[model samples]
Target: MPSANGDSTRNHLAVNPVFTAEPAHIPRNTLPGDGLAPDVAYQVVHDELMLDGNARLNLATFVTTWMEPTAEKLMAECFDKNMIDKDEYPRTATLEHRCTRMLGDLWHAPPADDVTGCSTTGSSEACMLAGLALKRRWQHARRAAGLPADRPNLVMGINVQVCWEKFANYFDVEPRLVPMQGERFHLDAEQAAAHCDENTIGVVAVLGSTFDGSYEPVADICAALDRLEAERGWNVPVHVDGASGAMVAPFCDPGLVWDFRLPRVASINTSGHKYGLVYPGVGWVVWRDAAALPEDLVFRVNYLGGDMPTFALNFSRPGAQVVAQYYTFLRLGFEGFRRVQQTCRDVATSLAERIGELGPFRLLTKGDELPVFVFALRDDVTGYSVFDVSAHLRESGWLVPAYTFPAHRTDLAVLRVVVRNGMTHDLADLFLDDLRLAVERLSRQAKPLRGAESASFAHGASAHHA
Candidate 1:
């Protein structure tokens, strides 16, 4: 009994098939050697997400990438979940309502009449909605004024995000760009006014330029538009694309009058994922009043028996992100948000100051201007290029974007760092330390690292000239 039982147990424990029954030719570990295993990629991604508590503050382009456990848990709950329960989540409408109210108050919407807004997947969709609304309103105004409908255009700075171009392309409207020069990085009031005529639908003044993080002097733009309106009798309105700066500006620069306080600004659109401190796939568009939102744009859908009013380009979005945004508003009240933004500003300023001492690098925009800081190689750094330094930084796992200035400033390449949530002082220090190391390494390199000329490889440019 012992012999048979032991033999069978030993046989079962063998790592390979029994030689007694099968031919022995292959090794047990023989398998294809793909470069990356799925499990390994998953682990690396998990590590990256958890780095700095995922509060690395690396995303200055937006508020921050959401990595809070609460956000993750909420997202998991919403995956593959339906959002059409009229009975259970009847108060679900309150989610959008609450966000609308918060943004309305922050943006300083008028005290009287009904203010209208909606949540979108991101600022891109919000911009699309804003453009569509402006177009519809322009058409109505044109019909009322008995003007020729042949031409309708939007005036904006060349530094505007690509979405503006897409908006014009999608609606068949002319995109009248106010080109940027060396001294002027935003849409000049003079240039913007020149583009406006009876055919102009709206002038989009960016509160925060995506390229430089500069505010486009909304007050000046509005005042200039007012003068044009009085002189030309043109009723063109202003739309503020505050995707990156909307939330942070209120707390950091409360005196800034880029919001609804400006008489000409008809609607304000922002990315909830950016400064709102929510995860991606959440954006908001707020019209001054119900009258601003076109009736034809809002579609009444009868789902789960009751009719629900929907206006977004894409329907059937997950409710989890919305719930998460509402949670952020509740969790981080006004004071909390201000404190967080202030922390980012302070850390970014510190990094800027530290980097200022480094040789051959010039600060393009002051860190205090916004959380984003842009830098370029100084003239004294003859042999070394910003592009070369960016390649060095990449070796150390930094994702700082470097690129050339748009249009007129294409000859100059710059680097930019976006300070987002989870970017603590310590993390900033680490980044600076790594940057120093990268700089030293690049200095010791034998050759210059020039970026590829093609747009496909443009990611390399974001590092040195972002």
Candidate 2:
């Protein structure tokens, strides 16, 4: 009985609503609920508060936040490339050129015919591409040298990120691991050279190690490779994995020649998100020249004029991250990056000094190269261990991760602190206070198995079995 305007009509069917099966093809115009509702801004802001309220020391891994104004500008402007054009926006290409030039200058590379580089999702993909390039180049050189192609191998540290192992596994090459030991927490140049034979493709030198935030002696590694190549009559190259250190050393320690300046270092890869002060998911890799990246490794895609060569593993990532990185370069310049890095170093040193003074723990790495600190419980702590202290710290809301040292150093478990940009002095003090409280609380607790009989049984049973 209702008219078209009434609730009973098709346009006004709410009154006698029947939950029919969704029509075979519901018209776009006749949607029911608001397609997009529930704004997430408030929820996101709430989460930030929760994160801060909990232990805010955040030495777990390398994560960071930009300053308010800087973040606002990055989010607002660079995210939306309204002015960019597929035809004219050559901004992608332009940004690539700019970054390549800047990195070349930062790493001190001589001008050459084939200075090539690409932006990536992160250092992982960049590393993959570097590995592929090395593989291809080695194959090409092998054919020319009339050497057997079956025994291709890559030399690298045992403590290397799993990506290196995956690279070798995927390429069906031998991963000649150079073991790390006391005073040698990185690839030993002599040991790595010893693994090299006619089939050795390249040696990966880490500019910054993840475990202890130390630099592998790239100069010494390069020297070793130089000697090997001279004696073997085959070309061997060095790939610098400068993921975190590349960004730090340029500003804090400029005199280092670990990059392309070293004769044997043919390529370098870094995570822009790590130390470049950009958000996650941006990385870079640059070859000394076009020759370093074999031509076969590049593929021409139909999207960007099939004639243009593409080097990246990922195809359609948001251009926003790239623009943000370029913006960081323009806004911070060289001096700004240096100042920020210097501040990070100072803060790290200050925290290390404070931790040292507090007692019950000893510092691991001297905060000189990278702003990361590792510490272990003092030798005298009887019932408690570093792991126990790590658990206590977590109760206070800090997300510090505790793990055993790599390979041969499994006996030594240490806690690491990675000081990112956002952590302030006040936050550091709070973390220290919580750490002290954790130690004191742990010490006060009596051990469940304090008797000599209990101790004797545990060790005596093991000895009896042996």
Candidate 3:
């Protein structure tokens, strides 16, 4: 028997009707007694997420915010596949290998049938893996020569991403960070040479500094290490943290020699999710040669029904991101990637030009290298600070981050904007308008901004431009 309001053929039954009407009140902290309808649960979560900052308008992060519809479809389809299980999902492994080869070739790896590398959860894991390889290789050489393999140390600038610090802490390597000063915000060859010793594992040269969108002098650092090796008999390799620039320099500035083109660059790591034009959570680490990555680091496991050599920090991650990366590589070949990166560089340059014209700000980096830039308030402009302008921009849904420099350069506070793939000239123009308005609003504030003094520590305190 069906009611007059109900369809005669449909069964009108409810397992838990209590939550069906008032889904908004669903307790988020604890598990419910009974599950609600799928749509109801989805709506509750989705509605709450609507309040989050819009991804497209976020200028502080270097992560990709958009992708093609086809890439989205492909990622959705392979979301359930686990990347670690090479036996069950062999094709995913194949795709990963192909991607590695492509990256190796792109980075100018010597002509070889296979390259040693792996996909990571992000640039952080990729960096960790690269650090491990460098450490192991150094240890192997030390042990062969009957030298002390203990007290391994890594060298980099204070401008390095925090992941490098994490790598040092987690892996028992000493972090010798070079302090940044005035105009020199990156690790120079002299600074790196000063940090080297017999116990030094490797020198980390940042291809794209997260500080001010500048590319560290990789070749110069390598040459400095070469001289150090000749003088002190301590041979140290170079690992390029190409998180953002690896993808850009290859296309935008082909003349840049920050990659394997330099002989001493043993390994390189890049975020596939950043400038690689893919969504979040994908990174790569490619060694110049198979010998650069020690055999002991790769774990050979047959638990997945095949002999698979795994060399990653995490296991059982989503293979969909890797697939999306492959899709991006295939869809956007060399020419396509070049055009996209060139356009982003152009937009960033244009924005930098326009923002520099604002008169209150002094351009730190001109966004000519990696589609990113940083600027500081002129000393003459005393009424308002970058923090105030940052706060005002938030009202317009723009997430421009303002923070002080690290270590020796902490006195200089600046604002940074990371222009990604989807950011266009029109969006840049709109952002400029909003930025101008924010500056205007900040100028009119009667008192100092709420928590203005502490605001410098809020956003990019630990994180640099990238």
Query: Which model scores highest in TM-score?
Result: 3
Off by over 4 Å in 3: 1-25, 302-306, 450-466
Best by lDDT: 3
Candidate 3 shows a clash count of 1
Q: List the residue pairs that clash in candidate 3.
A: 210-465
Score every model by TM-score. 0.84, 0.82, 0.92
In candidate 1, what are the lDDT values of residues 1-466, reduced to their tens digit? 2364332222221223422333233122343233334554444446445644233434324545655797788768765544444345555566767788888998999885545888888888999999999999988877878867768999998788888888898889998987768778779788889889888889998876767667888888889989998998987899999887787789999988888888789999988888788887789999987777889888886645777667888767777777888888988899999998888788878888788888868887766756777788887675666667666666666666667776666777777787777788888888889888877777765655576342222321123222
The alpha-carbon deviation from the true structure for residue 8 of candidate 3, after best TM-score superposition, in angstroms, is 44
The digit string of per-residue lDDT tens for model 3 on 177-225 reads 9998768999999999998899999999998787789999998999999
Please write out the lDDT profile of model 2 over residues 1-466, one tens digit for every residue: 6556532234422211222332222222265453222333333235446645342355765644554466556546655453223333466656766887788778887786545888888888888899888888888888887877887999988767667877888888898877668867778779778878878889888877777778888998888878887898757898999888999998999887788878788899998887888877688899888889999888764434535567877766656667777878888999999988888888888988888887778888856778887787677766676667767777887766566665677666567777777777888888889988987887876642222222111110122110
The whole-model lDDT of each prediction reads 0.75, 0.73, 0.87
lDDT of candidate 2 vs native?
0.73
Ordered from best to worst TM-score, the candidate numbers read 3, 1, 2
Better of 2 and 3 by lDDT: 3
lDDT of candidate 1 at residue 52, scale 0 to 100: 43
Arranged by lDDT with the best first, the candidates are 3, 1, 2
